[model samples]
Target: MKPVLIRLLLLLAWAPFYTQAQQRFSFEIEGGHFLKDGKAVPIISGEMHYPRIPHQYWRHRLEMLKAMGLNTVATYVFWNLHETEPGKWDFEGDKDLRRYIETAGELGLMVILRPGPYVCAEWEFGGYPWWLQNIPGMEIRRDNPEFLKCTKRYLDRLYEEVGDLLVTRGGPIIMVQAENEFGSYVAQRNDIPLEEHKRYNAAIRRQLADAGFDAPLFTSDGSWLFEGGTTPGALPTANGESNIENLKRVVDQYHGGKGPYMVAEFYPGWLSHWAEPFPNVSASWVARQTEKYLQNDVSFNFYMVHGGTNFGFTSGANYDKDHGIQPDMTSYDYDAPISEAGWVTPKYDSIRNVIGKYVDYVIPEVPAPNPVIEIPSIRLTGIADVLAFAKRQEPVESPVPLTFEQLRQGYGYVLYTRHFNQPLAGMLEIPGLRDYATVYVNGERVGELNRYYNRYSVFVEIPFDATLDILVENWGRINFGEEIVNNRKGIVGPVTVNGMELSDWFMYRLPMDGAPGPDKTAEVRAGTPEASFLHRKPVLYTGSFNLSETGDTFIDMSAWGKGIVFINGKNIGRYWQAGPQQTLYVPGVWLKKGENRIVIFEQLNDGPKNEISAVKVPILKELKS
Candidate 1:
């Protein structure tokens, strides 16, 4: 025998011995059922994102899942969350993926790793780093070489961190997803050729294997998009509403009447976008689905067992066929079995009871609910003007309007100022106003252009020579649709005044992420002494209160128009009183006893009184759609 063949044969001879010594469990597919150590087993999994929840609460959430009769925990590893800036990966704090996986294993639960270069979980830029937008000839989630190179680099780093945790390496991770719902995505898009889509899937799978993932690779697609999204050699799984027969059909068709069917994303509850009421999938409906899967001996995973908060400007928007530019609210509390605040709900009981009937394993009692603190109302004073604060930011001069990425701005708002040379009047057209913009003449609010309403240009009547300011807020990038490619924020084209192209523009990038607090209030006052609430400029409201105890609470923003909030120097999330989500969730882990600080950067504060209140429970279901 050849030396290489002899060595390989010897390694294979010792494989079982080594695996046994390592206490490694064999997880694979046999016939049509998931088998563990050659015994048929069903995977009862629930989806959770570690970054969305506090690092301290991982175990608690895992325990909740386990108590609810889940044997596995599936999680999506967000690329953007880890690689926010190119070449700079952040796995510390809540972004730690290895720790999360190990914690699940320690809880006696298996894990299915869904590490996506593009995780379309209503996440900003669909989990692609915003910096990728500036790359030359970069096309995301497709067969672009530049995009694939960046993806490979990220995957290489990811595998280095958690690849050893796979089942073959004696870790609890049994399977690693090839990519998130790719078959469904490339199905209807004409921009990508079907052959190229298949090649891309094959390339990603090859890359994963090269990175040393020995476990089974799988692709998730909606039943309708199974043909296009499925990889030729990998396991194919379907996701959708409670329809077991349809799921089986999709799996069977993909596998050539083979077994081992799986539903990757079984939606117990749906995601709620801004302005739309929270989607409340009935507990009985969830129970019925859970029962059906258990009865049919089918392996399934809940889309969100615990949909946590989408902190900061990480929330995404959806461009629907019927509704245009629908932005997602910051509160990701998807009304799941485990609430965003880490508490169990009625759905928990329903699902637990249903699963208990089919399984012989005892389901533990649900843990006691955490104590919720009701904070008294906090009075906030308008401390500074945002434009006044903008003086510190070095302005970029441009003849035409610039996109946010063009000026190295990631999120939040941007200010485009132009000093009028002569008296100008008529329609001020920003042909490519990416989303929402507030038009101001000489610092006075005139009109607003909205992307959702398809209202772009606004009539500006400049009486005399005055400065024109268009403060644009990036509502959100479209997370899913054909509009994903053209989802650049700010102005992507020229700004015209009465059919005349305007030049000599002063662009100020307002990425108000880490704005200074009360100490910097003096700077704004010094910059614009005449700045007042009467003016339509952005306002930074500062307030501090003493907390006797720290617990989960919802900061009420029913009175506020639209803005983002910061508590104790940490960004809580954005809030808009447009009905659905009226409050932002404040995790107890973020708060401290004694003096606590809050700063609000209100884009449009409709105020007779600038104040905020906190309640004990989260307002999960929206009162209006």
Candidate 2:
């Protein structure tokens, strides 16, 4: 043992193959034409943001990536994630990006780092700190001096953290993408010419150079990703282009010849929203693309090998106004080969089968799939009454208006309280009510807004000396697109009543935590989502099952409204009544026999009571099956 240890210590090359492997890398397109070492390496990679998976599961997730026949793991360097606050940084917790890099190396995988100070990955503020938005005349992504200053700061910090992880430094990072799909949104910018693109890349280039990091820099964009994206230096990048000729355009247009070609984001399955059905593309179609890429030696990266959660308010939405997609569910389940929980799907197996039959490498057996058991449905009734506890003791003043930011609360509800001038009631218009709102006159519920539709309405009646109160909840910010850049919570703008804009609002905050606060349970009074079922402001219910032994189970979500679920004490994820997500995956780790507590906090009411149980099968479509 001593001799072996000495020999191993003496041979420093004992590091993993990825850590010791060296390759000159470049991007080519279509037909597996990307060349490395003067030959096509025909890379197969998967995108899994480091912050998405829990650190404990990093290696597990990487192993899963490798098992999927992926030779590379791409991750985004979420600036906001690293630097939670400006000038301050945290590389631990979910921010341990350095570990993410080293782990990839250890797993014999390559790395593609996307360190966008403006990484628009459906993150809050597109990865910008909220304080940046408060800056005067501040602009993000493009060339705003404030934005540039901040970007540089983040770059400096990043270099200090993991610059050595580059392949040039004998690490797994073979390539780095400048920004994702920048050309897709160039028109919204200041309409600057290509020179603007040059300036951005130039600054990045300068930073990398100054850091003594010479791992080969490249910018990636579509054949036209260059239009809005930083061009010249950025490697030409594309996604989901199955045709060899189409990829040729990107490489030919940029490299003028051929080198390393890659699909930075190859979409296999699509993402689904609250109301929409699953956005599933055929697994066979995706398998064919993978087969072609490898057969032709084209290197590619799956857009999301694992799409993690948009926890809190960071979920970005499509079109700027909708915060649905970006904030993705609490589940980072991208419907990729790998689910958010690091479980490999059938897509993974299909992709792996072809790679095994066709490629030179052999991947190990995957960790056993999570336990899935069906819990016999339980009828849940009025365990106890739930209702609101009044906090304001004084005579409530005129209608008070409060903005989302002023509330000092990130997500959830905000209360605006003010006294009316005289006996009055008319069509109430909350023009500045940003996302979602629930109108209550004198502590009685009157109306609500879906926000996704931009409107939810009802009539209002007031008595003499009436107190005006409108509670607007920051349901969620739009999780994708340009709108995500400015996603603020609560009543973003203002609250209006009739023709007058309410002012001097007294405020109340309702984050509601997860599920419902049990102590605030209301008497089971009503039975519809539109009515107040809980007489209490918050509600809580508890149930226990003696397992004697714990087993994996699928908590059927068909019976519950929108709320969160907990086992023992871990948050599984948010649950919505909306289908096709009728089940929540619950690992047995959080459960215990002899009496594990299950608590539920449902905000809206659709029925008098509900039921929950476990399932032996995955309730989701295609991917799980």
Candidate 3:
């Protein structure tokens, strides 16, 4: 047998022995370090979100983290993914938090659970359920009574799922984080009293403790914002902080000058938004920081050692004083050590080398990359126009446009239409446009408005008795900053033309939660003529391709425009021609060895060609400057 093959075989045989079921162990913060069973242990950890990854590949990803010399795996429990609706909880399949933690424990890895009532992981509404907005007098991340009551209920339910997995209960969970980065939020909103922030933080901490999370608790924030975020009894940790001296000083300052310092979220690479260049961090630079952390005995967890994809409409946006609203791209690759497709980059080797020098145990061999395959071009034809379907829905008539939450809708598109009796021509303004919108007058495409660019108004010439339609899409809610609380989708305020408020409006909700199919009641033809399709409205294109063999592949949507893709009824994610990310990562597990269905919801595809290909590689950074 070949030497390489023999080595691999031996390693496989020894892996189980090395990762045998861990005995009951005690983990606590003591004397400036993490003490596991009375021994000081530096926590070499990395962040990986379970919902972002396919459940079938969870073990593979965990093993890859182990191979990188990480002893602990930290994950944020996104509340939105589990309890999507109020009182409607789901913990099975991909949303299984217990399975994820158990898989980590089985791999001889400790877990640090960040069960956030508010996680802010660039997720929709900062990991908040959309139903929260519908609650009467709801104010999140504050000392509001309604918010607290709902938060307690959600946390109580979460504890029921994985509370037994805590280290205190003889499981692998060593630490549980309190509210994520509360200090940053408090700092942003100066109008709120400091006492209210303190009360809210205390309430969240109490809720976690009361919910049976007996594991050592900690709160993470930027080095400068520790004052407002730190819980009284819990250990305080820094985020995005690399300077060992500053980190230690800040933690000490917050925790009464004591020790047990840790950097909860050390960044290897930064998050990328659509239309921007993919952020890249040097492997050597990260290695140097890793070396410093080890040399100083500072425990750290890479913010994302492996950032998976943001499937469906779960991606969030960010708003600032300078930048209005910047929506996150579909790919959450984050340029981490592990790629979104579960392949290790040079950064993985660099960090592993640094870790090997400090760790007592041997680092496992890097796991082999997942297999990939490519498919030939597949032609897709338009089946139904989204606008036509919207017209069929019974409209909600009101004097002004209502928000998505007011309409009992969550994420998707909403169409606001109005018919004018007189010919009014001027600038049409929708100042409360939540995200993105397309304007159409008399079945003709007029212009597009994007919230990312803060373009809310556009010129329009309306003929007498012409019908006007404004199709607004909730790209994503703001996950970070002070604007998060006020994130209401659709038109929240009045629609004006020539400084006059328009009244008597009709609205249709197009959640687009599932792939659009041809309406059976209507004479909707399956492959309609391209010229006959309404260019102003979104179109559903469908096609099927046979695959004798299935493997992981990237659906190349470069030929298409802005829209979402669904494979075999699974909503993979949204794609846009705005560059940065052009391909959607398709896991091999989602494919079969027979014919696989593909559907595309093309929003702005005015081009002639309507086809896509399944490529082996991803196109994450194709920015058009």
Per-candidate alpha-carbon RMSD to the true structure: 5.2, 6.4, 6.8
Q: In lDDT terms, how accurate is model 1?
A: 0.81
Give candidate 2 regions above 4 Å deviation.
1-40, 190-194, 208-213, 308-314, 320-327, 373-400, 419-421, 465-469, 511-553, 565-572, 587-599, 606-611, 614-625
TM-score of each: 0.93, 0.82, 0.94
Model 3 Cα lDDT, one tens digit per residue, 179-283: 999999889988999999999999999999998888999999999998789989889999988888898888888787878879999999889898778999999
Q: Highest TM-score: which candidate?
A: 3
Q: Candidate 2: how many backbone clashes? A: 69
Off by over 4 Å in 3: 1-22, 519-533
lDDT of 1 at 412: 88
lDDT of each: 0.81, 0.62, 0.87
Model 3 TM-score (2 dp): 0.94
Local error of candidate 2 at residue 571 (angstroms): 4.6
